[model samples]
Target: MKKPVIALLILPFLFFVSSCNRGKAADEVNGNEKKQTKQLDTIVKKTALTIDTVDYNKRMVAMSNNDTTGRWPVKAPYPLPGALLPYNRIIAYYGNLYSTRMGILGELPRNQMIKKLQGEIAKWQVADPTVKTIPALHYIAVTAQGAPGKDNKHRMRMPFKQIDTILSWAKPINALVFLDIQVGHSTVKAEVAELEKYLSLPNVHLGIDPEFSMKNGERPGSKIGHFTAADINDAIDILANIVRKNKLTPKVLVVHRFTQGMVKKYKEIKTVPEVQIVMDMDGFGDKVLKKDSYRSYIYREPVQFTGFKLFYKNDIRKNWVMYTPAELMKFTPKPVYIQYQ
Candidate 1:
């Protein structure tokens, strides 16, 4: 009877000890999780502050032409965590893979073209040592065609393989890739949806050429085409959704505009933090003409950012010279994105 009593007492003691150990283990795990979460929070805050420092706003004011008007710097919403505009200068090479006549991206062999791009990047780096220069391959994924294909869109879509090739090249260099759309008769919404898989990537961006939008069913190249603010908004909305869905950094959207009609109702274009919009001066001419075009369009109608395009052949045809980075930097709100064709 005494033995049985002792066993019952011991059993209760063992059970109590086991319960305490389990509780202790749970507490330890919870403590570890809390510590890890706190560390992660600290790192994220530090990164955000580093990326969006006070200097970004200061630089914007400096770029603005000392205007009392609030429109110069465009009081758009601050971008989400990983925005790049006004922070780094993008030096891009533009072209389509099918035709070498389009631009330098396809004009030369891959190695030679990349070398040439690196040289240009060096020049810009030397010109503006403060801002880092990032190289980009701006591929024309949708090309406007003279003859309407079976789809009757008046545009040809490059196969996925070519885009894959561009991505493959970009990986080795850590370069950004921009898939440009010339939407011939197709809408921006439709064309952009097709490239969703690629654009979901963090480094991939977007460019829309109003010069070939061709909204009136007219043949592309017959006359300069136009895109309304609504058309541009379609792209912005899509990009914003992609960024949010994939938990990616903000994506850059380049809008090519050399003339007033190329982009219409610029004021109505909504500015979202998820996408950075650059109104690129898409003309090729002497320094005087190029500057005039930029001031007339980009400067007067301020967007979130600005871009300037340089044509290797057309820009120098008139003056036999291209505008140096130093000279181009003198413009009010200097271009943060520079494209060479």
Candidate 2:
């Protein structure tokens, strides 16, 4: 009888010990998760601080009178200026061939010409060895001026016939291709619907041009139409969903901003943890703004990744500058991407 009583007592002790250990393990796991969450939050906050407000009108005014760096407003808590960050690896730009052609003659053979252009891009990889073999992301711009859609219904448009050639060529090279839309008469939701066919492809991304999204009577270059932070966030949400459904890597949403007003509602933009958003400072000119001025005014916005553009002829004379890649590599907060025109 005494032996039986002892066994029962020991059984309860064992159960108590096991329960205590399980609780300890659960606490440990919870603690680790909290730490990781805090780390990610810090990174997101830092990225948000890097966005700056650019004023094109002020810049143009400055440029007309030969004021090189344009006029950037003064702000507080200045970060160390200069090329303090090396941009990210994959870089892209508006297609020079299509952009230039559309700008001048206002027309081109959309289908055949794009295919030939893709072949030319393949040749460029070999011709310019310095063009960064890091497999760039290309944004093919579709506008009303060229490749007009049937019945004037913009949303009915599809990727140009030559787009397949580019896609095929890019696949072999391990590059990414994106369809960029100016969205003159379409909504963000509408444009995404048109682009749904390409979402299944692994190496494709998306870009939106607020520069071309204007109200009635506004021209592309007039800076009349701008996207609200909500508009941008909505587009990001749609892309994130598509990326998740297709089991693809995070989709990249590229936004071109030149001034503070362009991203006025930046603070209100929603943050989607799944997607990577890049805001590029798309300004053109030769004169360098005071590196400190840019950091204080522009690079201080809330964003995940930052981008910079170096015009082959405009930003750097002789297609080169004193700032070496090594020096560029030394930036404290490196740029996520760099673009060369």
The best candidate in terms of TM-score: 1
Shift of residue 307 alpha carbon in model 2, Å? 1.0
lDDT agreement with native, every candidate: 0.87, 0.51
Cα RMSD (angstroms) for every candidate in the order listed: 11.7, 14.0
| Tens-digit per-residue lDDT, 1-341, candidate 2 | 02223444454655554555554678775665566556545555544533232332242232123323322221112221111111124544345234553221113343443454444344434533433334443544455332235644332343456457557656655667766666755666677666776855666777776665654545455454577777688788887788668756567677766665666567676655345666666665433452342354345664545555555445565443533334333332333454544
Candidate 1: how large is its RMSD? 11.7
At residue 225, candidate 1 shows an lDDT of 98
The best candidate by lDDT is 1
lDDT of 1 by residue, 1-341 (tens): 01223434454555554455554678785665566556555554544443344676887777664756676788887777668887789999999888899999999899999999999999999988878899999999999988989999999999999999999888888899999999999999999999999999999999999999888899999999999999999999999999999989999999999998899999999998789999999898788888899989988898789999999998788456888998887777878999999
Runs in model 2 lying further than 4 Å from the true structure: 1-88, 96-133, 144-158, 290-298, 316-332
Clash count (model 2, backbone only): 21
Candidate no. 2 TM-score: 0.58
